[model samples]
Target: MPTPGVDRWTFGVAPLAQTVELAARLRRVTGLALSLEHAAPELDALLDALAEAERRLAPLASADPAPRVGAAVDGDGRVYLDHSRHIGAFNPGFPEYEIVVDGDQATGTVNFPVAYEGPPGLVHGGFLALFFDAAIQHHNCDAGVAGKTAGLELRYRRPTPVLTDLRFVLTRSLDGGRIRSTGELLAGDVRLCEARMDAVQGDRARLPPVSPRREQPGPV
Candidate 1:
């Protein structure tokens, strides 16, 4: 049996894993089909199952764990971790993005999987942009703005490989009611992309309520 907070193979209802396996199998079978007609039905069924699984996992996938950054805010409007670990541990995998803040600077990292591949084994450019967007938002939050993306621009330098670590570094250029930030994504020593963003603090009344997810328990 798996300990608390560690993802383990459960006896039943391993929805995400099951769905991932099924999708992989479908992709393989469809690719090897002798004719287009032979693959269509299996492809259609795979798409339907994948869509349903994603719908069920969306909410859980979107939930943001109350980050432990010194300035982090919890779902109940409380501060959690006063200091955060490195970006890798901060945000593990999937559509999630992780930020590690130090003073006015932050770093983000995301590990793309085969599911997020774009060209062959490369990470999708759209997803790379999403990571930059989210990283900038987290940097803004660290700077005490509590705002959303008002504007963002990205320049892709090279293809980011799926299953490789993509790192982003953000520095606050301006802060106040409106925040201006600059950042970049690196694959190893090579620069993959660069970005800048502006975020304006929205009316508190118009802002959606925040409910932070609970942190997973660490090794004892």
Candidate 2:
């Protein structure tokens, strides 16, 4: 059993609003550029601009010792931690997915854009495993008990298509000091993959304390 109202790890940490915005913009740009069949010569100037931006921010980034992994305060004065699908405030790699928890079950919808395609419009297998891990942890964190993943097993049942709407469902159980979660990635009625995980149950108060971060950089 877990304590009620105890602090749990969360997502949506909007640290440095401008920086997050820049990350979103970079994400969009990366998608657009990757989908293009040929590169425009004009992009050379864009590359140069990006290089200059990187050069300018390098020193400031080196000076900042604060880690971006843990908790941080957002613009609204509320505290949040960014272990969600979006990852860190400046990270644009992970595709954001929707999830909702009710009792022992969690349901979510996600779309894999073209950027995540691996084989002829199919999402890469590795990313599917990543999604299961994140989704499981997200479910646990939201359910008031969570822990480190002791083990994870994934089975690819079918080719998961990209640029399409997909759904995921997870059900968890607490047993003998461990959290056991099982879930599947589905496209409509078809199951694309299945995940089973064993995790060591953890306490909310055991999560790391919030730390200060400076020099949060925008897209560079």
CA lDDT scores, all candidates in order: 0.59, 0.76
Across 1-220, the per-residue lDDT of candidate 1 in tens digits comes to 1232232111111223454565545544543552265447776886798799789977644266543233443333332321112222222232445677775688877776665667888878887777776666655555544455788888888888876777878887555676787888888779988888887765544533333435765889
At residue 113, candidate 1 shows an lDDT of 63
Q: Which stretches of candidate 1 lie over 4 Å from their true place?
A: 1-94, 203-220
Best by lDDT: 2
Supply every candidate's count of residue pairs whose N, Cα or C atoms clash at under 3 angstroms: 2, 0
For model 1, where is the 10-residue window of minimal lDDT?
Answer: 5-14
Q: For residue 152, give model 2's deviation from the true position in Å.
A: 1.0
The candidate that achieves the highest TM-score relative to the unseen native structure:
2
